[model samples]
Target: MRVALMITCFNDALFPDTGKAVLTVLRRLGVEVDFPAAQACCAQPMVNTGYLDEAVPVVRNFVRAFEGYDAIVAPSGSCAGSIRHQHGLVARRSGDAGLATAVARLAPRSYEFSEFLVDVLGVEDVGASFPHRVTFHPTCHSLRMLGVGDRPQRLLRKVHGLQLVDLPAAGECCGFGGTFAVKNADTSIAMGADKARRVLETGAEVLVAGDNSCLMHIGGILSRQRAGVRVMHLAEVLASHEGAA
Candidate 1:
């Protein structure tokens, strides 16, 4: 199976480690994944911000870069959801039947990391061993957009020595909705503060979520409060092995 990693622009820039961790976990699981250099943003930002006309080139580039891969795996549900649910809209808006056809062919092949692991790979335990108290926050896109219910939790539960605590209001948005945070700073901070409070209530040493964008927002709040809590990508936690500190 030809599998490609669609490292979103957010991770490619701000959280490169998250992309690396995704490679680590997938490679450890015996999945030989490829990183197509031509890949770029999934055009989610433009689509979500009501700039579908402007997102045409990006969506076009996405399909071209990832074309022919049996599967395109993304660590972020936000990007994956965009590809699956939004790319088609952008293609149609461009009035390019060829682009529409391309989007139709490639979008369904995209898979969020957790969905790929639990659904496609059909493995719960990837032989990871992280001895830490971790709480997982289900990102809005992962939970609602992709319907990735309990898949992430199921994988976390199998990590040896890892204690997966239930995050209060796990389904609530962390207010890191890409441009939503920028356009609505006050509302975003308020929601992030609420999420930080919930993370602290778990008393977990680390906060884990599939999307680092959400983590960055909540982590910023925790950092300001000196919460001493670490934020890690779900891939990073899954990539952890015994005695590798």
Candidate 2:
């Protein structure tokens, strides 16, 4: 199937490698993937920050940019959740029937990385091999919004020689709620500090999460504290094989 890679704004800027890893993994799976040059943010930021009205143009651009793909796949659960859950709210809040209809048509076609791999592609192993003790952090959108529970772990477990470890306080929010970080800096830092501590306690060499946004937030604190742990996106780990890392 032809799939459009909806690279989120942050990933486009700070974590381009994650986007590349996602593309490489999908292409390795023999799936047709396209990167639409016109694509931008899914308007998740504006909608999350109580600026639903401001998100209309972004939502429109998203729909227009990805008009042709049979399915939309993003490396981020937050972006996928925005398209699947928040787009309609933004449209209706603005009283735009046409925009809502457009979102309705497009939303169902979008899938988070894990969801597309486990639910649509129907496979646990993407034929990747990464031999390291790694732990997973279930980002809020992936866990609470998308309910993509254990799908990521299932895929990780199938990787040859990969050792998956349980993260302490798994399933807790890392407090990188996009704009929520700025609006509530202290609270965000406190939550991130706690998450970083958990990552350290796990004794895993790598901390993996589906969303890089959360990793960025949690990783910054961990790095600042010199935690000595590496933060990686799931796609990156999933793309690594015997000699690929």
Model 2 lDDT at residue 226 = 87
> Each prediction's Cα lDDT score?
0.93, 0.90
| Model 1, residue 159: C-alpha shift (Å) | 0.6
Name the candidate that leads on lDDT. 1
Candidate 2 clashing pairs? Answer: none
Q: How well does candidate 1 match the true structure in TM-score terms? A: 0.98
Cα lDDT tens digits, model 2, 151-225, are 999999998888999998897899889888998999999999999998888899899999999999999998999
The total number of steric clashes, by the backbone 3 Å criterion, in model 1 comes to 0
lDDT of candidate 1 at residue 126, scale 0 to 100: 87
